[model samples]
Target: MNSKKTSQTEHPPGRSSTPAAWGALAVMASLLAAWIFFESLACGALHAGLTCASWMRGDQLSVGKLTYEGNGIFRANDVEFVFGTTGHRSSWKSERMEIHPLHLVGMLIRGKYQSFRLIRELKVGKSKLLVDRRGAGDGDRGEASLPWSESFMNPANFFPSSIEGGPIDVVVIGDAYRLSLSGLKLLLPDRWAGKVAFDEAQLDMGTWHGTFSHGAAVAGWDGTSLRLENLNLGKETALHEVTLALRDGRADFGIRGTIGKALIRGDGAFGSPGDPNALELTLVGENLQLGPLAELLGQDRRASGTVGQARFTFRGEPDNPLEADSSLRLVANNFRWDGRGWDSLRLAATLTGRKLTVSELSLQQEENILTGKGLVNLTRDWHEALKSPFTAAFSATLDDAGALASLAGPQFATLSGGLAMEGEVRGAENKATGYANLQGVGMKIHGLPVDWMKGNLLFEGDHVVLSHLDAWCGQDNISMEGSVQNSQPHAYKASAQIDVHNLTKRLGQLGIKTATTIGAGAVKCSWQGEGTREAHSGSFQARVTEWISKWTATGMSGSFDGSYAPGQLRLTKAEFLQDELKLSLKLNASARTLEVTDINATRGEKEAPLVQGSIALPLDAMDVWESGDVLRTIDTSGPFAINLALRGIKAEEIEELLGQKVRLTGALEGTISANGSLENPEIHGGLKIGNFVSLAGEAPADLNLTIDAAHGEFKGSLSEAIGQTPLLQMELEAPLRVVKE
Candidate 1:
């Protein structure tokens, strides 16, 4: 009866009975409350569990807001996670983090996750990152997705080494990680970059990918090892593969790249970027183009060459970096630099903390070689280094000085002889002190012929001291000692002691006409001159010895004390000594004329006749320096005079001049005065012979003569006679004629 009645009480589909609907509604409501309660409890439990785990993990976890949604989903707003000790902690913040309950539970229960994802947009300092993990296999094999943008790639946020700029993807596969970029632009700081060493180096890649493997033993990365593949930097610079390894406070890297037309192979290692203990490093490059390298260094000049092999090594620690050990070597072909070039170059150098040593530095071309070496210091600033204190020793040997014509200028273009020099230098570059000894054979300087030359030179600042110089000047040996100063404009002081052998031959070689055929002499001179090259003035002193010219032998000893000031030169003392002749003169000169102030001459002893006079000589008369004439050119414009006094004379001496035997015994006394042009003389004087005798088949005769040169008349009378033809008289009148020899 009850079953029949329940079957008969069926309600329409759209409408239900009040009692049945009420009961169903109550059951649904209860289920909803239970779902809500479970969800809330799950969210709360998750929050509490993570908080407790954070404490155990030495992490500080904070959440701004926590909420739960349908289907076992939970979200946290403004979540923060801090790891590490308080003293050195790192923190990460997330705008929002989402968790799927079922997936989390599965990961926990399985112990090893096949797949799991924790999605968040995280930030560290000023950078933001999107991190996700797809799967984890016992914490060893995992697939992680870490995408970053420009705002998320900052060097300071990570390690001390620098990096910047990226829209990159970091992917994980098993125990390895990769960074992939379609177009990457990167800038790295110096001291840590692989191929380029600069304050900042830039690398542009159209597409690049890198991978690295890490171990659990390391806190951040197992070891500093980065492998790059498929890197296209630019048209001029590209690399197929590169590997960088940093371990044990050191870095090592290798690269195979292309720079312009040259294939580049490079390997290098150095200490940690900022390690306190000195920086020790070694770098080697093979087949590297210099042009592109110069461009990379921001230099204006372009170079063209390929370095066959180059090596650089550094050692030792420096407290101030000024005393660091460094060295460099280069082997290159067709090397060009600074508008000058060389065919092949090989250089090796070493720099200790205190000094620099150049073991080998040379340039080779066919049969010519130029070698050089020196010592110097290195400083942080080039200018400071150039001005710092230093001592250096250098030696150069050249097969042909013409090979260095570019450096020696056009004046030395014709230099074609072997040259060698050894020198030592001390002090700074601008004001240095040094000594150099140069030797040359069969050489010519500025068209001055030299058979063999040797010079010892010392220099200080702008002052040069030529201590000793001996050279063959046109088959003549000349030795000179002098000093020259160039500290001021046109202000020079020079002193020289010059000794010449075979002066006549040397002068002839110089196109000079000389009266002397053979001569040897020494001149000691000192001059202090100032002004332009065209004109100069100063004090001058000269001492001459053993000077013999023409048929006259004079200047066995001579002295000249003179001074040139302004436009005038004054000779206060000029004297010469001969066998029995002595001459002294004083003179003054200007641009117009030379005035002879005083002249005195003596023969034999002090009792001999003395002559003195003055002459004004035109400056043009002293053109010996220009005409190269050894003979004196004395053409005077003003009045000229000669005074002569004669005492006793021997007959044998008269015969010596006349070249004929004369029978004469007499004492001659006369005073002669002449004043006129040197070419023609006007004489007014008288001669008297006492006890004179002429042997012409006759007896002796006393003769008296009267001469009036202006009137061209002479009167002579023989007063005493011992034989026939005594008391003879003669008078003559004739035109004056003077002969010059």
Candidate 2:
């Protein structure tokens, strides 16, 4: 065999070798060529697949045989690849084959022309890729990775348009739900010197669907960064549903909870990345629970109503810090609040930086209304915020009839008037102060009318100051100045002065009537008091120039001191009723008792012997009536002056005082007492008495007091020639009477 091999190798031309030698040479050459071709095909298939099947399970890959066409072209059919990166694991499969002309040409040329370009497109039918925790190498539980940041694979030089009729579909399984991508396109950057476009895409994850059309996105190496445009997302969940559209703005997603149901939405750019400080954006459909907001913000919704709608706007620099300006407007109807029901209510407010400003606030209940406009600054810098003072001014007007009717109690229902108030509130840190100018403060009590009052009110700490107060009611004007400490609804100590003009008119307004305007007098009074929530206690001292009108039956003036403590009122001073009567009366309001001492009265003139008396009066027996008619008409142009009847009196007294037996038919009456004292008297009946009583120098021994009576009846007087002896010291007793008949 050795000699034959040598002989066949050395043969030159037309030399036939032995059959055995020829057979051995041909077999060896065929074996070498077959090995080379098989190796090339294997290398081409591996390079095209871009996966190492040696490390994968047999079931994970379904790569078929590789084949070589003409012109250095190689193809593989029914290939599948499995891989993982960081938090992701995936598998991809295709039914058809893919061939890389570049790889085939390079292998055929044997590295000769190292820089060569080949086919620009490749495709496969029915491609599928999956990403799950089991394939991601992190066990089979917990969250894998962010879906947008997951690792994915694409063909090296395959443009999106060449990959069949449309984009390949991709499916992903995540912690929340299964995600699907449809009509996806691969994009390559200009820096990569590749021509590819990701024109349209759609993502479906649970109830959320995101679609991007007419846009392109490029994914960097390692998939760390992705740039996309013309994106839109729509979500529907249990709490709230939203649709987001973006163009020419960055997309940043920071979501927690399920895929579509997120408690917060933080997607969108903060301006350009290089100029993040100039970011401006708007957030919508952010549902904020009122109860949670109140709890988290230290705000209470305890006022007797409901809070309707609320919204906020946020704006700021992204790199340094952030701030927001927020506004909210609320509407409520028939809102019951502050002890009353309100109608037509609206409140609008805004918060800018650390300041809360109320643009318009109004409330209306029936005819009573309140309006407020103000700002509350909560900035930390004291000096800067203090310069503005967190101030507010409010004006309120109450329709007297409606307001009083709403209160309904005796103290308020009968009141009728209007009140207007304007005020400013200022504050800084822990201290707050305020000042207000008040006008048109009026009150109508028990049908008495008071008109426009002017005053200045101030508040500092817990003290309230009332200064330069001037008021008018009927014919009387009053001025007051005072300060109250620890002033609330009832707990306070106030010292004030009250002055009056035309005292009679003031009394008449209180339902007291007399004959003369000369009853006018100036009164100086001081009051100091403290009160509990239910009651008040105080002491008052008053000095009046004249207590009674001179044109009436009596004229007197005096100073009096009184104290009212809870249910009790006591008067201590010198008090006189008639010009002919003098007495020191002590009144105990709680006991309802009156004690008259040192009572003396003279009936005759000062030049003659006067008739005097000592008597006790019972205050409980007195009858007091409110005067209904303030206008007392007098015929100054007539011959005889007409006398009006006293409101609290009787007809019988008129006849006796006039020394006439007269019967009265009118409604007016004079008060009289059986005790023979004017202090406690009753109006037995109504009458108009107009007559003159003449007094003699002295009492006669018989005291023959003859009197003619008419118009009204009288009893218990001198009668029928009957008389008492020792008249100077005897009680006058008789029954000479006049009857209305």
Candidate 3:
């Protein structure tokens, strides 16, 4: 009753005040004060970050300059927050972030979010932020948005709405490639799923770098597919519109682009867009220019032509392309390497690891073609490959040598023939071995048709053998068989027959007509060569029958046996035989000296000497007549001799060789000897010219001379009188080496 009286205050409508009402008012006042204090704290700088460890449970949520605008508008500057809930570190921060004005309270009060822009940085599993790209045509389109990071939205809801600040670098492969993106903006319109647009994107790999500008794409709602617009990959490579779909951590993509000067279309599947490790692809190329591409690879600068068509498939890691398992088929049009050209080229091959298996290979130039199939080491140098051992069936044909004028010479420009070779080739390099069945049909040389030409060509080790080879022109034919060794002690053997009539005919056909008279005849020859590193030996035998010419004796037989070393040569025997004339010679020579002995020319079978001579020459004597030191050969290689004897030789025989009528008869005998250095030599020799006749026909032109030198003094006198005045006389007590300059 007392409390009622004391609390007899005014009440709105007959209501009594109680202790509970006062307590409620006190609690309300306390709460108002606390709310004001918390708001003040929220708007202030908190460099230490507000650690909500107990309830909200998070790392440092640092904030700066948190400002509150009336009407539920709020902004946070320099704020950072992280959510490590997906068993992965995912964090985001911004220098200036705009909280969703409409749903800020709902996001804080109920845990539902619309969007906010953390335009600075984001990280997830060593990767950068994801962007939600929305179409620009959408009426509601403004900026991109990102998803709220939670326990479930590892990457799905992590797409950011907008990206600012610096570029976001995303490493596609470890040290292999780096992709960078800038100015990313994403939005969600009403109808279509979403879209993407990039201000710039850069890709770097090894020595190559590519930049794409103003790229755009139409993306599916679930972030699983994208259709990109045209984008140029620098100026070297480019790509057009294509669709990329992702499923089960793999992306299937198809695009048309250019590689080097080639137009390429391809479709493939790879590990993932974020990080691709393995791939399976199929690519087709058309009109692929070769020269520019070859230059890019730093190969033959002269390479040219085009690959008409190519198809290939590869399945393996992209890092090691050559190690991939692949199959290829290529057709090249008018392919050329260096200066050599081919009308077309075709190749079908498969590669596994380092082995390249060829199913077919063909090269064609006009009617000439070469075809073969074999295996090769794909990783080996091409030069080494050419020198490697391999087995293959090869077929080659040569038609119309005119097409190869640069190689065969201009004389063969009009040559028309078909030569075919088919065989199995094995081994290579020093031990190369191969064989071919060679055939020639309708062969013509400079419009002169050949009756026949057939042969078998084979090679084993270092020797090349030509067996059962024969050539015929008109009524003339020659059988030939020879072997040529290519080793250190190289050697060769050859045999052939020469028909003068045919030879003259062939020469006449070559536009080189000669007026000199010649007799019909045949010459047979056999020659061989064998050698060692320091010495070489060779022999030749020739027989001429029914042969006669105005300048040469008729029916001559000759034999030569010789050997040569580094700087030395020896003619063991050299002899020639004509109807009634014979000549024999023996010689030895070195770099600095020459010696001839046993030299004689005889007539008749009785072997009567018509002329004989022995001469010695110290070649080093030339050194004194030249530059520098005047050390004559005689000063070094001493003791040499020279002698000559001429007997009963008619000048008419020599006149026939001159081919000019200088009426003369008889022969002259002469001798020469050296007794000192080349600079000053003691001379003891004589010449008998009285036996000869002069053109003046004056008394048969009797003339002779005598010479002698002693103590550097020279004396000579005419043996015959020149019209009663001793034809010529000379005497000198002074050294002949001295001259009045």
Q: Highest lDDT: which candidate?
A: 3
* Selected candidate, larger TM-score, 2 vs 3: 3
Model-by-model lDDT, in order?
Answer: 0.56, 0.47, 0.59
Q: After superposition, how far is residue 621 of candidate 2 from its true place, in Å?
A: 10
lDDT tens readout by residue for model 2, 225-330: 2333323232222212222222233333322222222233333344432343334444332333333333333344322443343333445433222134556666
- TM for candidate 2 is 0.36
Clashes of each: 0, 20, 12
User: Estimated TM-score per prediction?
Assistant: 0.42, 0.36, 0.57
**Residue 216 in model 3: shift from native, Å?**
13
Candidate numbers, best lDDT first, in rank order:
3, 1, 2
* Deviation in Å, model 2, residue 13 alpha carbon: 57
lDDT for each residue of candidate 3 in 1-741, tens digit (9 for 90 to 100) = 878866765435655489998899999998888678755654552222234221133333666667765444456676656543222333455556543233445435542443332211221111244222111112222222233322323332323333223223332332245566765444333225555556777766666666666655554333345665555544355566567766565678887877577888988887631232357889999988887566544455565789999999987655555556889999999886545678998999987876778889887898888778976554344445555556667777877444444334555556667767688756656455778776667787666666677888787777878776876776666676777775656666655444433344565565545334443245555545555445655655544554454445434455656665566667778776665667788878775676888888887866668768887766642242232233333333354566767665456655654344658765656666655444455678776654455556555555676778766676877655545655545544445663312
State the TM-score for model 3. 0.57
